[model samples]
Target: MTVRPTDRLDETVGIDTSRPHPARMYDWYLGGKDNYPVDAEMGRQMLALDPRVPVMARVNRAFAHRATRWLTEHGVRQFLDIGTGIPTEPNLHQVAQAVAPDARVVYCDNDPVVPARAAALLRGTPQGATEYLLADVREPDVIIEGARQVLDLTRPVALSLVALLHLVPDEDGAHELVDGLLSQLPTGSYLMMTHATADFTPEESTAAVERLTAAGSTVALRSRTGFARFFAGLDLVEPGVAVVDRWHPELGEPVPGRDDGTIPGYGAVGRKP
Candidate 1:
């Protein structure tokens, strides 16, 4: 693993490397070196269950890219990306700003490790503005407030919850939180999301969920119906809610093995009409 420069994060922040965090494990899956042994161990177990787990992560990320590109092309100049994960190359802002140089983006993640390397995230074009917020999605008020600093809440902003909702169970009021955040935005704002699901591989997905919950990470993989409910009252884009690979594949390259194996996820883009 290549040793990338750490961002020399704030010392007061709390980061527990003792247990595996979803962000770190996700980084590990993406062939990044930011994760610890605990994260790799859990990721290995997940891979053992389904060797295509890494492919699923990549597919979900690709969905985010295509959705961001579509939103930018559709004239969305502001973005609020929660569960922004580690600072992967060609991030949401990269994809958006590539189309609109002045795009403003707010990236939020619960992981301190991500902020530890947020400098890479801040390296956007001078015409654009990018900021990282260390907050949890369960608290939408805090996220919305922090996002307002960089993004104009009155404008049409794309609220991206890509590969995030599974971490927040229904008991945690995930639907209510999304509604609250959307309530703060204006009409024509978009909601772009990709979620893990058990509809394809029920038995394996359930086992993976149990294992993740056992390791202190909640994986509330939703079904097609449950995932669609998040966009209730909003106008779904063409093709409606579909699998990650099926949602606007023309906008981005397809992930290998995404179809050979069940991706176990749903991706969609909706306009707040």
Candidate 2:
């Protein structure tokens, strides 16, 4: 069965189309029509600085798909995907449930636009369950509490933070928030994540951060070491902390233009022992 957001969610947390949202900007990058003019404007600026922005987005998404498949094949039956953006084809639930029909998934995102199109995220196999929570990652307790409605807190759950933490700067206790969520899961649970980094092109990355900050969005691109810090205390899977597309390329198709230049992102899956 599918669990949905409350009807009052949209009214209470109104979509602020006046400013550009990261999720909408991401959608625009993916060639989706869910973004506004402001989002497109910022996206264009990002493209101008690095035309690989769209390719990076696709590479990040592909990482999520491949990571999901790997987790399911390895016996994971539950997933808690935070920072889920606009519903695109073959969402986390689709990939997981396809591999294991009984897989259960709980997707959480702060974007108001997500709740509007969350139904697209909730569709899953009859043997599985899919749910959406209209909440922010900053409030780990809220996300955990909501997820409890659908997932078993006592069991192992894959905590997915794809393209998310970069938006959460240090002042927000990004690392602390991640630890808080992982602390609630079982020992065998996993942390599957992808973070955009400035390790490859510091100058361009710094400029991109400035543009997003000016537009009311936060972008804290981490270095390779900083990106790996999120997985501290966990055992990283093989080919650990690799460039986005380099991680398990055998599991999915390559993103076009991936080899054209550096993707400037890190992706990995780590198991909590």
Give one digit per residue, the lDDT tens place, for model 2 in 66-102: 9999999999999999999998887998999889999
Angstrom error of the Cα, residue 205, model 2: value is 0.7
lDDT accuracy of residue 211 in candidate 2: 84
Provide backbone clash counts, one per model: 0, 0
For each candidate in the order shown, give its overall lDDT on alpha carbons.
0.86, 0.90
Cα lDDT tens digits, model 1, 121-204, are 457778888787788898888888777777788889999999999888899999999999999999999999999998989988
| Root-mean-square deviation of Cα positions for candidate 2 versus the true structure, in angstroms | 1.3
Off-target runs (Cα >4 Å) in candidate 2 are 6-11
Model 1 worst lDDT window (10 residues): 1-10
TM-score of each: 0.94, 0.97
Q: Model 1, which residues run further than 4 Å from truth?
A: 1-11, 257-259
* CA RMSD per model (angstroms): 3.8, 1.3
Clashing pairs in 1: none
